[model samples]
Every structure is written in C-alpha cells, then in structure tokens.
Target: MRRFLSLLVFLGLALAQGLSEVWKAVEVPGGICADGSPYRFYVSPGDPRRVVLDFQGGGACWDAATCSPESPTYRRRVEVQELLLAQGIYDRLSAANPFQGWTHIFVPYCTGDLHVGRATVDYGGFRVHHQGARNALAALEYLFRNHANPERVFVTGCSAGAYGAVFWADRVLATYRNAQVALCGDAGVGVRTEDFPGFRVWNPRLPELPGLSPDPEVYQVYLALSRAYPQGRFAQYTTLLDGTQVFFYGLMRGERLPSEATARAWAESALRAVTAPAQAENYTFYLAPGSQHCILPRPELYTLRVGEVAFLDWLRALAEGKTPPRVRP
Candidate 1:
C-alpha cells in the first residue's frame, strides 16, 4: 500500500513538471510593503507534499538616512515578476534542480526589518512602516492554509532574506507538525557590530525561543532552533569574505565604504559566529572562499563546489532529510 502511494506521488510530481508551472500572486489582508503599497507574495504550483518558502533579500536600513529609498540601502517595494526571473533553485526547467517539482512560495522583502519587525518609525517627516513580521506571518498563514501536511518544507532566503529564513523556520515546523522541515540560510551569516541597532528600533515580536537574547544575534536563532527542533535540519551557506556583509558591517560602524581592514574584521566575526552553531549535531555550514554574497538564487547553486562536495548535491541532501557534512574554507 505504501509503495503504491509513493508511486502515485511520483507520478503526480511528474505531471506537475510536465505542465510547466508558473508563479501565481497571493495577496492577503494586512500585508503591506514598507512604502505603504499593496503587498502580495507569489506561489508556484508543484507537488502538494513538498514546498519551498523562500524570502527575497534586497537590503536593510535602521535610520533616516539609510531608510530613504534615495540612499539605496534596502528595497522598499516588491514586483511580481522577480520570482519568475530567479534562475537557480527556482528554475523548474533545470534537471539539476532538487526542488524542481516542489510548491514554491516566494516571500518578497521590503520592510527593512529582516522580516521580523513590528514597529513603525517616522524619520522626521517620512514615515517608514516596519511591519515585516506582519507581512511574513500573513504569507506563512497562506502556506499553512494551502499545504496542510507536506512531506518536506525548505525554509530559505538570501542576504536579508537569509536572516528571515532562520527567524521563521521554527514557525514552519510548528505549522507542518509532521513534515520534515529544513532551513538553509544563504549568505546571511548574521555578523553585526556591537553598536548595531538591536530590537529597540524595529520592535519585533520575537518567538518564544530560549537562549535568544533581548537583542539577539543571528547565530542565536540557529542555536535556539537546533535545540528546539532536533529532528529538523538547519544550515547556512556563505562565502569566506562576503563583501556585502562586510559593507553592511561597515555601515553599522559609520563607514560609507568598508576598508580592507573592515573586511578582515568581518571575516573573523563571521567565523566566530558559526563556531557554536557548527557544534550542533544537526546544524551545518558551507563557507566557500570568495566575496560573493548569495548563491541559492544564482547559477552557482549547481556549479560551485568545495572539496569533493558539489553545492547542489549538499543542498539536495539537506532537503531530502539527510544531514550533509559541512564544507568550510
């Protein structure tokens, strides 16, 4: 009986692939962009038992100068077509894609709150709505409503969205209850400065995660989630010297442009941030050597490799409920 059910699922997925899936926009009430515009997320139909919830990362801002769209700090809006344009894991045509026939929920980031803020701030006259948590929650609820009992759920994001992936993985686990939920944070190794604005500015309603500080670090989410969900897999992927991460760290330090010295400092901090999480049995990391930021949304997901392990293979293992060995520089 079980073999017959499995064969039926395989045939269903094959038919889904044969149909050439396209993204469909889902708009929920209370979902709004940072610019106070109507916000909607995109979903692509695929195998009903497998789902991928991806958060789109542009950038983030904390103060008035950075918050201004003119400053080029973060994305203040989202477009429906961006999801269809992304090539890597989202590329349904590629045979190398592990998630080719999985249901995809593309979560666009515009709240500048790392997808976990709840406060609104008026920087002088320009009001910025930091309701990332609200927007993300609405999207998650939509996933819960549509996919009641998935076999697997891949929670992931790049850059700012990577942080979102970690922040929301616990909730995904809670919703699925019986599903194999895995988290992969692409290029969002949370390495921020001491002076970086904590939770006070954005005022996120944090989950009841033990070991998470009042002003939490990115690794805290990793550690907390690993302990909280031992059966679930949690992982991170980042370049050894991520230029964008260094650039953002420089911004927190009041530098308009980061010096080479700042890059070195960022590397050290990033390495230290991964230390504790790396020790977790289920938490793994892939630290490739380069300055490039994100890979999951790019072609590098298939071609890039470290040592003997291809990134695509490692990611496939993670999505399939296997704890792939970590690859580090």
Candidate 2:
C-alpha cells in the first residue's frame, strides 16, 4: 500500500507537469553575465494575461575586495544560476501559492550588480561586467514583444532581487500600461543612502523624486514609485532582525555587525517613515519577528501569520485590489 501511494503521488506530479509548462531557459543575445556568458531567463507558462516576474538574488559586489574573482559575492552568481535551473520554492505548484496559476518568469542574477548596474568596470586586476540593468531590460523587452497585454502583473524578488523589484517598478508599469501592477520586495529594505556609494559604479538611471536628494534610500525609491503610480499597489516584507542585511551594512561601512535589537530598531524607523504619510496609504508592509533574511523562499511563505491573516492571503488580497492590514510584529 505504501508503494501504491507513492506511485499515486508520482503520477499526480506528472499529471500536473503535463498541464503546466516546466521552467525553460531562454537566452537573450543582448544580455551578458558578469563572466561574459550570454544571459538567460526561465519561463513557465500559466495564465499569460496574469504574470509574475521574479528577479533572482544573490549578493552584490562593486569594488575590488567584493568583486574580485575569489570573493564570496562573486561566487554567489554561479550559485544563483544553478538554483534557478532547479525546482525550488518559487517553482512550487502547491495550492498555498497565490501565483500558482500565474505565468512565471524567473530573471537570474549573475552580474554581481543587484540587477541594476549599467556599466563594466575594472576592479584592480579583474574586469567585472556590470550590465544588470541592460540584461533585465532585454528580457523585459522580449516578454513585451511575445506576451504583450498582461492584465495583472506582480513584480517580486528576494534580497538583492527585492531591491531590483522595487527599483524597477516604474519601468515594469511602463511596459505593461494596461496591467494592474503590484510590487513586493522581500528582505530588500534597510538600505541607506550611504550604504550605496557604489551606485555610481552601477550608474542606473533612477526615477525622479522632486524633493529627494540626488542619492535616495531604497525606501524613498518605493515611495517615489508609489506616488508616481497611485493606481498600483506596493508591499514590502522583511524580518525585524535581518542578520544578512546587518552584515552587508557592516561590510559597506567597515564596522562590526549591529546587534539584532539595533537592526530591528532601524528597520522599524525606516518603515514608519514610509508608511506614516497620507500619500503612503497604498503602500503596506509585513515585518515578522526573527533574524531571518528572506521569507518568500521558506515554508513560512504559506504558514506565517500577521495577526489574523496569513501572509499568502494578504498577498492575494493585494493582487485582488483589496487593502489588507499592514503587519509589523
């Protein structure tokens, strides 16, 4: 009976695969990786009119110490590429996933540039190609040409990818004029203006905010996008105490890692600044209590709760044009 049940489960998965298109890689000639290989993306078809574009995240590198060939940040690009080729949390077809039936596009990050850089730089003796923005644009153009007119779109990413999603929300909205768009940045908050002096290295053309300084924080970027597109919804999620962000910030500042309590305080303060204003009514956030870095890639994505609402349910409400409660634990 056990063997029979196992057979039944295998058959069920096979049937599901038969109905849904498996993630397939497609190369973009204009997109190039940091190592100079052709860039590629993975696509799994569902309801073409409803699409979920996910940007893959690793770490990022801007200077010699971080971008060197032997640096751990540089190696993350290879790991991210390998993971994108395998079936993982984002590729699951479980009923718990709000985007189970939506068309999925996985944008791999291998440029060591957080999917926003636009230049090639020589770091010490190593030449690092920082063409992340161009690669993303090329893949987006391909989607616009082949799968135009999506009615609903969700742009999301974890860690570095989360920054990409928030940073590029305006461009995504511009590409799909008729779509009801939503942006979710998981574990991508807590970035300060000073943490990003390397922005000059990426040289991305950021959105214009009238009163903001020339170099703005990531939260400010989200605010700017929200005010610019009132018709769209914006959401962000992160652990109250994210060690990964704390470590990254420390590295950028050349200091020891901040305490978890200090990190949580910083996150809360930044979040309040963004969500307190009347103009931020369309923006919401979920801050869970933990030292975890990302929520979307874990089982918590389905089981995690904020008050009386499940995270997945809250996300579904956002996609359905309903304003769910803002959770900050």
Candidate 3:
C-alpha cells in the first residue's frame, strides 16, 4: 500500500510539475478542498531544512474553475506526504541548499492580498483566514518528514502572519534545537488561551503590546518544543507605534475590525508573548522607536530605517550561534 501510494504520489507530483510547462487547469480529489481541488507553491525541492510554504489568503472563494486540485496551490499544500520535509521554523543547517548556506522558510497564511479598509464586511478578510499560520505549519510538516528530526525548522508570515511566526516558531523552538524565527506580524494578532498552553511572542519592548490574539496551541507548542531544548533563547523585537496603532491594526482599528480595547488586547499579547518564555534563554522582545505594518513592503514607516531587514538579520544571528538580543520587551 505504501509503495503504491508513493508511486502514485510521485507520478502525480511529476505530472503537476510538468504541467507548469504545458497545462493550466486540472481536476482534484473529493472532500479535500472547498473547491475540491489542490494547489502547489512551486518551490524547488531537495531542501535539508523545512520547506517554506506561504499560504496566500484573501477570502477569495474562487470557483472550481478558478482553482483546481492539480494547480500549484494544491500541490504545494499536499506534496511532502512522501518526502523529507517539515515546516514551522527550523535551523537552516547548510545542507538544505548547497548554494544558499541558510534561508528560512516563510509559509505566510494570508492568501489573497490583504488591503485593510479598502475591503468590506462582505469579505471578512482578516476573519476569513485568521488561522493561516496553522495551515502553513501543517504544510511544512507535510513536506519535511525529516523535519521530525530537525537541524531546525520554523514557520512565519508577513502582515496577518505575525501570530503564525510567533506561535509556530515558539512551539517548534521550545522543542527543536538551533531554532531562530521571526514574523513581520503586520496586523498584530491577539493570543490568549483559557485552558491550554500560552504562546511565545517576540517583538521589541515597546511601551505597549500590539494587540491580544487568542490562540489555542502556540503557547502549548512552545512549551512542548522548548521542553526538549532548555538552553535555546528566543530572538524577537518590535518597532515604536507613532500613533499608528489604530490605523494599522488595533482592536479599535481592526487593521480589519478596529477598536481601542482590541488594540489594547494586542498590546497585552505582545507583553505576554515576550514574557511567555520561562527559561533564561526563553522570551525576548525589541521595541523599535516607531513602526507600523509591512516594513518590508513600506520601510519608510519604521523608526529604525531598516525595520524588516534588521529583523531578518536577527534570524540569521539566531541560526549561527550568536546570542542575538531577545531584549526587554
């Protein structure tokens, strides 16, 4: 059964990859996707570390014709059942790609282009895919079976992806070694769990938390992953909020919903995320003087000129053996 499945899967993958040169639309499995089809990310394989599977989101309820099982989106999400791939933040041990000594996988959860106010209630963009991080992690796991024994593996996002970066990285890091991860948490997600484990968050020690995002597993994942490696420290940071909190993504300003208490909740999560790490090497946060969402997209908004670039540098430092500052968030 395994061998046949493997052959079938391999053939399917080959067919999908080949389609890039020839076909466009294809059929899909039943009950697997909303549209009953699959898509692929089109990333090159042979990675030593986990694969970076970015999930593009936008409340785009594309018709069956718009998306299909044989498409890049579906293939990327499903491929890996038979391979040695894993996701959710991992050490970029030089082996993944002989060319790039190190490169982290960022499986952002947001699907469609998330343009804040321009959107409407008809399309609850934020709510449509709040748990994109979870899917990204799952895809990573699916791709890298070798991820089970990581040199290191991790997952993160950009705008709505921050929560995913924090939650998945902390969970996998707490357990995996040589782990360093970051999320450009654009819209600030709120994290709170009533009965399960809390999340491990990292951002600069700004005057306030970004917003409170409720999570059911990030914190728990952190504790579980961290329990295996007790000495690993978390590398994190945040930029200053020059009155852009509400405009960017506070509760009062849902980046999607908008609310003051909501923004406060986000800030609260920021505080908890930094402090969530229990060990000496655990949580760390950096509060840039003034910053807002998508510095990578709009670097001009950062108090520290190189907001997003600096964050990636920190990830590199964490991977290599330097005790990058987790700062006092």
Candidate 4:
C-alpha cells in the first residue's frame, strides 16, 4: 500500500510537470526504416528558445551478414515505447540533466547506415532500405520549419547515433545560424578497415566538404565540421575499451567475433579518431576507462566521472559554450 501511494505521488508530479503531454510524433513520408516501415520522430515541448536534437543509437550494419534481421548488431525498427520511457538525459525529473526543460527532438535510428545512407540495397533476396540520410534530413527539415530560431541547440547521439550527430551538426547549425550550437558525439567512432571498404555499400550522401580526403573517416567529418563551423562547440565521449565499437571494428574487418587483437586495434583507431581534431580549439574529448559503448542516454550521464571532472559537468560545460578540458583516464 505504501509503494502504491508513492507511485501515485510520482504520477501526480509527472502529470503536473506535463513533459509527457507535449511529446508530438511527427512522421515524414520520405523517411523510412530498414524494413521499409514508416519512420517517425518525437518532439516534446519545453523552453522553445533552447533545443536538443538527440539521435537514438541501436548499432549499424554494413554488409549482408550484419544487416540480417537475425543479426544482433543492429536494430531494424524504431521502438516508440522505449523512447517515450527513456531515462537519463530524457528524464525530466533529474535536475542534474543539462538538457532539462529544453525542447527535445528525438531522431530514431533504424536504417543501419549511421544516419547517412540514401539507398536501397539487395542482400540475397532481401531488400533493405538504407535511407538514413533521408530520414535524418526529414527530421531536420521539421526542426528548420518549427524551431527556426533558438538561443541554443545541442546536437548529440550515442553509438551509431554519435556518427549521426557528427554528420548532421553542420546542417543543424546552418538552419539555426544565429543559435549557439554544440555537438557531443557519444561513442560511435568511425574506424573502418581499409582493405574491406564494405561501408561503401551504404552509398552515403556525404556532405561536400572541401579538402576532405577522397575517402574520409568519421573523424574527418568531425574535423571538417569543426573547421566549417568555427563558432560551434564540439566534443566526443568514449570508453577506453568500448566493447560495441570493438565488435563493429571486427565486423568491418570480417571477424564476426572480435579477437583480443581486434580490441587493441579498435582502441588505437578510436583514440586516433578522437584526437585527430584536438587541434581545433573549439573541440575537446572525454575519455573514460571502461568497455561501455555509450553514455549520454544512460544513468552514467550524471554519475560517471574521470578523475576530478564528472562527465555530467563536462557535458554541461560543452552545452553552455564553455571549454571543458580534454579528460583522459
């Protein structure tokens, strides 16, 4: 009976808060999932002057094996219930959340293309729509139309969504040209195998970045964005030995189950990727010690720390246009 009473009070407080009441589901006809399902994103009202365009991560697929529905590496559909019930950064009850009370646009990932593909590929007899770029653009178009002018906009994502955030921050800043835009890539670092070049299967419509290598990695995208948007603040967070990234790294190298060497190589590549853009004064990184894949959407967003600097505080500094020192464990 006491537990039930506590739940009632929590519900009453939630009702009074009204965060859940304002979540609007917006569907774009041009957007779609890997399975050709209709794609939709969610938006919740808050201080309209400030906004967060958060990309949802569920991993990625490059070739037929990983793209298979039976494969565990990637998600093929958007789960609305999961998004609506999410905690951590989305937890309005947490006053420590830097994004609390900010208008939120949740961009769901299901296309297995790191939110940059605009193609339909054939895997044996199966057809998968790698329309990530289309879906992301559609969601941004909505943001451009609805929240054109805001004081601040934080573009971020976890895992594959991290890659999404890195790729799309430029577009977001362009839309809100006057707004102070900050970007934080959660965990996805683009470390690909040169020999395989399998990611080409996605046929991503990359931004026409000048001076970028003919074939640029994810880090190059960050570098280009940092240079292009000099006024935008940017940062990245990653665990020293992120298991998910190691797995994907091996997959890119054609190893279904990554070996110890794969993890070592992944660590090296990920470190290089994050540090490559450190020359940009506007960019910094938070390197935690763990195998955790992502952090922004998890409770660790508030509790995790490296040395004396808490991850939450570091992120808050980035969001607030303050330069948080590069942290390494």
Q: List the candidates' TM-scores in order.
A: 0.91, 0.85, 0.47, 0.91
**Tens-digit lDDT track for model 3 on 117-188?**
111112222222112333444545554544555553434344334444544444444345454332223333
Ranking of models by TM-score:
1, 4, 2, 3
**Of the candidates shown, which would achieve the greatest lDDT relative to the real structure?**
1
Q: Write the per-residue lDDT of candidate 1 for residues 68-140, one digit (tens) a residue.
A: 8587878787753345455788787787899988989899888898999898899987988889998899889
In angstroms, give how far residue 18 of model 3 lies from its true place.
17
Model 4 misplaced regions, further than 4 Å:
1-22, 81-85, 196-198
Write down the lDDT of every candidate, Cα atoms only. Answer: 0.85, 0.74, 0.36, 0.84
Q: What is the lDDT of residue 108 in candidate 4?
A: 89
lDDT (C-alpha) at residue 174 in model 1: 72
> For candidate 4, lDDT tens digit of each residue in 74-170?
7788764335455678786678889889988999899988898878999997888999999999888888888868899999998888988887887
Candidate 4 or 2, higher TM-score: 4
lDDT of 4 at 41: 89
Winner of 3 and 4 under lDDT: 4
Task: Report backbone clashes per prediction.
Answer: 0, 0, 87, 0
TM-score of 3: 0.47
Q: What is the C-alpha RMSD of each candidate to the true structure, in Å?
A: 9.2, 5.4, 12.9, 4.2
Q: What's the C-alpha lDDT at position 45 in model 3?
A: 40
Worst-scoring 10-residue span by lDDT in model 1: 78-87
Error of 2 at 231 (Å): 0.9
lDDT of 3 at 13: 77
